[model samples]
Target: MQQADIIEGIKGKYFQKFGETSNPDKVRTFRSPGRINLIGEHTDYNNGFVLPASVDKAVYFVIEPREDDQVILHAADLDETYTFNVNDLSKPDQAWSHYQLGIIEQIYKKGLKIGGFQTTFGGDVPVGAGLSSSAALECCLLFALNELFDLGLDRFNIVKMSQKAENEYVGVQCGIMDQFASAFGKEESVIRLDCRSLEYEYFPFPMQDYLLVLCDTSVKHSLASSEYNTRRLECEKGISILKKYYPDIESLRDVTPEIVAEHKDELGDPVNRRCKFITEEIQRVQDACDLLVEGNLVEFGQKMYATHQGLQHEYEVSCPELDFLVDQTINDPAVLGARMMGGGFGGCTINLVKKEAVDDFEQKMKAAYLQAYQIDLPCYKVKITTGTEEIL
Candidate 1:
């Protein structure tokens, strides 16, 4: 559907729910898009590089300020309503409510004055597909609050605040890439972020004849949460070992391929493998960025395939379903590159495919995936879009 149609639908729903009681002129609308990492998986927390783009899929918030301190929220998709006191700022029992409450808690902690508000939010971003839907939700609400209460938080501050909300309140030790991408993204461009310094450079992404396709594996392993933490600890251990010899080194980002090779014996097999993948993956991001700048889509696609191999063999994050989906495009010329994205174990494989061949590739992959795993794979064709903004 068109962007105009989507906005109108959201506005219509908001008025239907709360327009009668609230003045139409007082209501404000906001939107934040979800992001997709083309490469550089598991590199964000390691203080390495990542390339991500915010897609057309987004969360929309329609809100109005209230005189009382009570904040009312309606999640249109889940058909659930939650009410809480802005002054209390306590976490809720419901899992979905945490995202909303966490943002509010962070804003209050920053000494920003905010009034109570009522909001209705819904989105097209797929849940649990590794599209960073949580970031979209947090950013949309935070952006709305900033505008509603006249909070003077800039985009960078909003990004950090959203990340803090998830880490401190929701108990997820996530990096700033997702929230940063959601808040700073631009249409027809991708941002290359340096996690350590929070520096970024944007490159035009003009893939006129190619498409960004995501194939959901529909299998989220039970170990995803535990394993994600385990990987973080392992990376830390590797960094500590390297730090002894090189005192200035902070993370794997500072360790090069030569450095890891020289101390391979001291790092051992497991630690060596993890450090090697991170160091190499960081280089891949740079190479991919160069390819993007040169407009060499073919080479850029090859780097994506290489990233998947590293995630599978070196990082030990890819599962069988994710591997099978990527393997399906091995020899196909129509497919440029494919890799399992997000926290791994199970999620979606982002593919770079020829525009004309997308349908054929999707149809065959769906049937093969269902036959092998008896699970249906959902495909999404995404377009890059701008970051959080107030809709007129």
Candidate 2:
């Protein structure tokens, strides 16, 4: 779908529900694209590097400011509406409202002057597919508010606010990569983010003959959330043990694979494996960046596969469904490389596939996946897009 069509669709829905009561000129529309991590999984919190791009799928918001303090929000996809006072700022019983409420709370905490507003939002981003839909929602609403109220919050600050919404309000201890990518992404390029220093540089992703496909496992294991925190704890334990020798070591990012190997006995099996995966994964991100700059897609794809192997065997995050999806692509000539992306107990496997063979590969993979697990797998073809912006 073209940009114009998307805007028109949102406008049509807004007018239909709101009954053209508000002045069209006063209404502002905004969009924020979802993000895909091409490489560097589980390395963000460790202060390592990540390569991510904002995709075409995004959340759209149509908002109009009100004079009163009452904030009205309508989620078009869920067919739910929520009303709250800015002064109250209480968490809603419904879960989806938390994303918007959290942002409002953060904006208020920053001392930004904002009046209540009525907003209707919906999007094409597939929920729980490893695409950062929550980040996209947070970013779009924050960006809209910034423009509406003249908040003067820069892109970096907006990214920080979006992340804070998730961390503080939503109670998820997430890294900044998702929100950063959604707020700072560019078309036809991927941002190489240094999670430690918050420094980033964009590299060209000229995929004229290749496609970025996500094969969704369609199953999110209950263990994903708890295990994600467990892995972080294990990583911290390893770092503390290494800190005995190298006091300067803060995270796995600072420790080299050789250093981990030399001190393997003290680290034990679990801690040693976690440290190895993280340290080597950081190195893989650097290597992938270099290959991408040289347009070495073949080698880059191989690095993705290697990262999956480490995530599977060493990090122990990959689940059976994720493993099955990636394993199917191992021997296919049409597939360059594939790996399970995101927190990883269950999610999609990012694939670099030949554009010409995407259809055949999808059909075969879908059939094979369904036959193997008796469950359907959804595939999404995503294109890189720019970050959040107001629609003209």
lDDT of each: 0.91, 0.91
Instruction: Locate the minimum summed-lDDT window of 10 residues in model 1.
Output: 1-10
| Positional deviation of residue 130's Cα in model 2 after best superposition, in angstroms | 1.1
User: Who wins the TM-score comparison?
Assistant: 2
lDDT of 1: 0.91
Model 2 CA deviation exceeding 4 Å by range: 1-3
Backbone clashes in model 1, listed as residue pairs: none
For candidate 2, give the lDDT of residue 69: 90
lDDT by residue (tens digit), candidate 2, 1-392 = 76677777777777777755577778989999999999999999899999999999999999998778988888888878888887777887989999998998899899877988888898888999988899999999999999999999999999999999999999988899999999998998999999999999999998799999999999888988888889999999999999999999988889999999999999998999999999999999999999988999999999999999999999999999999988999999999999999998888999999999999999999999999999888999988989999878
Model 1, total clashes: 0
- TM-score of decoy 2: 0.98
- Report per-prediction Cα RMSD to one decimal: 1.2, 1.1
